[model samples]
Target chain A: MYIRAAAGISPQSSFEQILADPVPVTGSRLQCMEPDYAKLIDPKMIRRMSRIIKMGVAAAIQCLEEAGERMPDAIIAGTAYGCLGDTEVFLQKMVENDEQLLTPTAFIQSTHNTVAAQIALLLKCHSYNNTFVHRGFSFENAMTDALSLLKDGQMKTVLAGGIDEITDTSHTILKRFGLYKKEPFPAGNIFQTGSKGTIAGEGASFFVLQSEASGNDYAQLTGMDTFYKPASGEEIRQHISAFLERQNINREDIDLVISGENGDMKNDAVYDMVYQTVLSGIAHIPFKHLSGEYPTASAFALWLAANILKAGKLPGGIQTKKTPVTVLIYNHYQHIYHSLYLLAAC
Target chain B: MADLKKQIIAQLNLKDLKPEDIGDDQPLFVEGLGLDSIDALELIVLLQQEYKIKLANAEEGQSVFRSVRTMAQYITDHQGKSTA
Candidate 1:
């Protein structure tokens, strides 16, 4: 499959911002620099949508617009924390109203598939719509579904995206579990700090995926693979090696590796080992500092890699000696959901 | 009636509209306020929660939610009769 077009609303304002002047984040969480949604979405619909829904719909519409598409054959969204704000509101109302007379808006918008459904509603599209809530592997699963649908001749154009949002309630709860750095630090020093926890980040990235090249595609999605709970760093190396072999590409053919190191000592150890072993000497860049660490954060990594291949330039701070032709994106969520995506310039 | 319009706006999340923008005799559903079935459900919940009025059936919603004036009249007639 190929990435026909890619657009995202991440912690950074835009890919151009990432290349020109990436802002430094200093906090426990990195929030998306959302656009004026009134311009991107209908004001009436925007009134009812929660934060994540607005971001997801906007990113998807932007991707479709970039591809010059009105309606995609399928819309698949992956979200781990789907519509958290609406969920909080719905549950709060349930308690406040003593389980009676609860308003339908919050409850209706609180579902995991609400974002995907909302996009379909806006498009008047009754095509195949699906949402994957597979925790860390959510976005990867959605992409895989899109690839399958396209490869099987089931669909021509598919809009696949990964979306997740951070809410005060979710952030507070995850903080109690020690998921974020207790002390504020510079985002640029995420790797240097060598801390116990990573910063919380959230974003929405969407891609227009097609099986055939459009001649203007961002990059060809060479291959994707995932593993769960690999026993050791050597096991991860073997997985990467096997994946590269299946793609018929040698480790030497890869010009860049987008690493998923998130500044956590425990979370980054595997990446450190991989760098020393299988992926050593590969010009690399870490993305977590730019897009905080979230379950489906690899979506942002894929979006970055695709854009980098399309632009033929690395982001401002990332120094690479060569213009990358083949890029490898490796991301894992706390070492639980490991995924590798290979991309090449079209 | 003004408070009822305020309640309707708040309950339905009609952020773009003000109470004064809605006429007292204007219909609350399609061809009037452009609300759909979902907004109708929300208006029902608004009546129960804010006015202490329980709608007897889905059919009653057609007449009761016809206009802000009708909703206010319904509330005046039924508010204390329903249990909270």
Candidate 2:
């Protein structure tokens, strides 16, 4: 199926602001600050949701609104750490209170599937509702599930998305664990250094997908592949060749390649193989410096790809060098996961 | 005292609480406090936030957060409690 309507909420901006510029990071170290919850969620319910759920709900609603539909056939979401802020709060309570008295709000909100479940409850969507949490491949896994379901001819329109939010506590933990760079790096200039760690980030991106193309269709998903183990440069190059061959497309056919270059020297090296070997001639764009490295960060890249396909104009911030983008191959690799997606203008 | 009621309401984040309405001997959980599990967690924060008493077990919390009466008594019992 093709992506009909899309909406995203990141540290960058909401749907409206995103449509205006839609560029890669002009500076570096981008973090998705939250939008106003009162605008997207009900006042009564707003009191209950954590930042992640609120962002997911807002993006989901915005996608539906853009699609000119209320409920999709299925709603699937992916998150690496579900509501970690609430989880931290709950755990603190457990540890401090010594298991005597407890509150259920944080526990209820901390569930991995809370975003999907909340959306389902609000829309009363009794159809297929699933949430995947497999670290970096969470969003890719959800998209894979959606594609399989579409192939089965069971569902026509599916709403799929990925979202993750960072709290102060989680940020501290990640910093302590070396998931983030120790040095004080400006949000801008993140890509300048061939550093080891990328800046932490959070955001939500949602897409309204259907089996049939619509007037607002952005791109068609030809193929998607995910690798579990850490692939070396040669191995990654071979895998890309195989993947493109399976889709009957060559490296030259890929007009644009959005590489997940998060400024990490080791991780960014993975993309170098593709840039130097496979997609040497293709226009390569990176968004992690702009969006920051979140679990579902690829969703924003998917949004960028779709918009680029629709606009037929490469936004200034998104360009590595000036070139027209017709066919985009989005390559994303995180710890223990690598995903490649081929999207072409429909 | 009315001050105690106000303190409880403010500490627990009982947005619906009315200072004058909370009797001295009123319950704090399902009945008077009307707090659910999340609120109870908040109450644990409240204990730290206010009285600086830290109960490290759910069983201990059950006793501490039983009622306004019990809570005040616990606070009075464990004077000079420090925050976690």
Candidate 3:
């Protein structure tokens, strides 16, 4: 399959703006740069919409409009913490009101599949729709299933996306779990922090994928694999090598390597091993500095990787002045879920 | 009934609307306020949460919820009727 169109709403100004210069997070918290959603979302429907729904729906519509498609053959959305704001509201209302009078709107839109279902309803697309929620591997699982659908001749064009939102209350709870830093640190230097936790961030990345490469292709969706709880760094090396070998390529053949390094001193060390051992000589691109940290931050990594393949030049960071032919994307979340995706220039 | 508009605005998160925008006799459905079925459900909660009133059933809900005036009348007529 090929990625025909891609759009991401992150902490940066716009997805296109970050392709060259890294924009320091434009917010105090790692919240997405809210565009004028009034242009994309209906005023009446947006009354009860949380920020996540607005970001997700706007990004999805942007991707489809870029592809010039009114409706996709299938809609698959992957989210780690779906509708976090609404979930918190529903729960807080339950506790505050003694569980007596609760509005059903929040509870209805709190489901993980709400993004996918909303897209389906908006497009009037009654095709195969699914939502995957497997923590860090959520987006990877959705892409894997999308590949299966195309392989089985089920659908030609599929809109696959990853959406996650963060709430202050939920971020506070996650901080209690030691997911975010105890002390305030500069958001721009997140990847350089030698601390225990990284800054919390949220975003939504959407891609319109088709079976064959068309004239509007950004890059070809070559291959992807996911792993859980790999015993050691040596295991990751084995998996990386095997994945490349299946495509009749060598580890060195991959021009650029993109790793999800969120500067968590403990977990990011997992990628350090792979970098030192296998990709020591290979140029690496770090994206979490720009996107912050989230369960599906890897989805934003895909958006960056595809643009790198299209622009040929690796743009700003790193010393790779020449264009890359093949890009390898490796992402790990809290040492539990690890994934690799390969993208070749179309 | 002015309080009702404020309550609906706050509860439903209608960020753009104000109390003066909603007419007391204006219909609350598609033509007047452009509220959907979900907003209607939210209105039901708003009524119970604000006033001590319980709509007997869906059949009676239509007449009571026809307009802000009608809703205020229902609340006034059943001031002593408490659902709690």
Model 3, docking class: high
Using lDDT as the measure, name the better of candidate 1 and candidate 2: 1
- Of 1 and 2, the candidate ahead on DockQ is 1
**Range of the 10 consecutive residues with the lowest summed lDDT in candidate 1 chain A:** A184-193
**TM-score of candidate 3 to 2 decimals:** 0.95
Lowest summed lDDT over 10 consecutive residues: which window, candidate 2 chain A? A21-30
Q: Candidate 1: list runs displaced more than 4 Å.
A: none
lDDT tens digits by residue: candidate 3, A1-346: 8999998899887646775565774333477888898898778777767789988989999999999989899999999999988888899999999997889889998888988888887788999999999998899999998889987887899999999988889888888998887765565676566888877888999999999778869899889988888898788888878877887878778889999888789878987888888777888878887777888989989988988888775645566746798899999888889889999998
- Candidate 3 — which residues are off by over 4 angstroms? A25-29, A184-187
Deviation of model 1 at A299, angstroms: 0.7
Distance from true location, Cα of A276 in model 2, Å? 0.7
The TM-score measured for candidate 2 stands at: 0.80
What tens digits encode model 2's per-residue C-alpha lDDT throughout B15-52? 45588777667666786646667667777766765666
How do the residues B1-84 of candidate 3 rate in per-residue lDDT, one tens digit apiece?
899889988877888989999999999888988877788788888878788687878787778888889989988987778655
TM-score, every prediction: 0.98, 0.80, 0.95
What is candidate 3's TM-score for chain B alone? 0.89
TM-score of candidate 2 chain B vs. the reference: 0.75
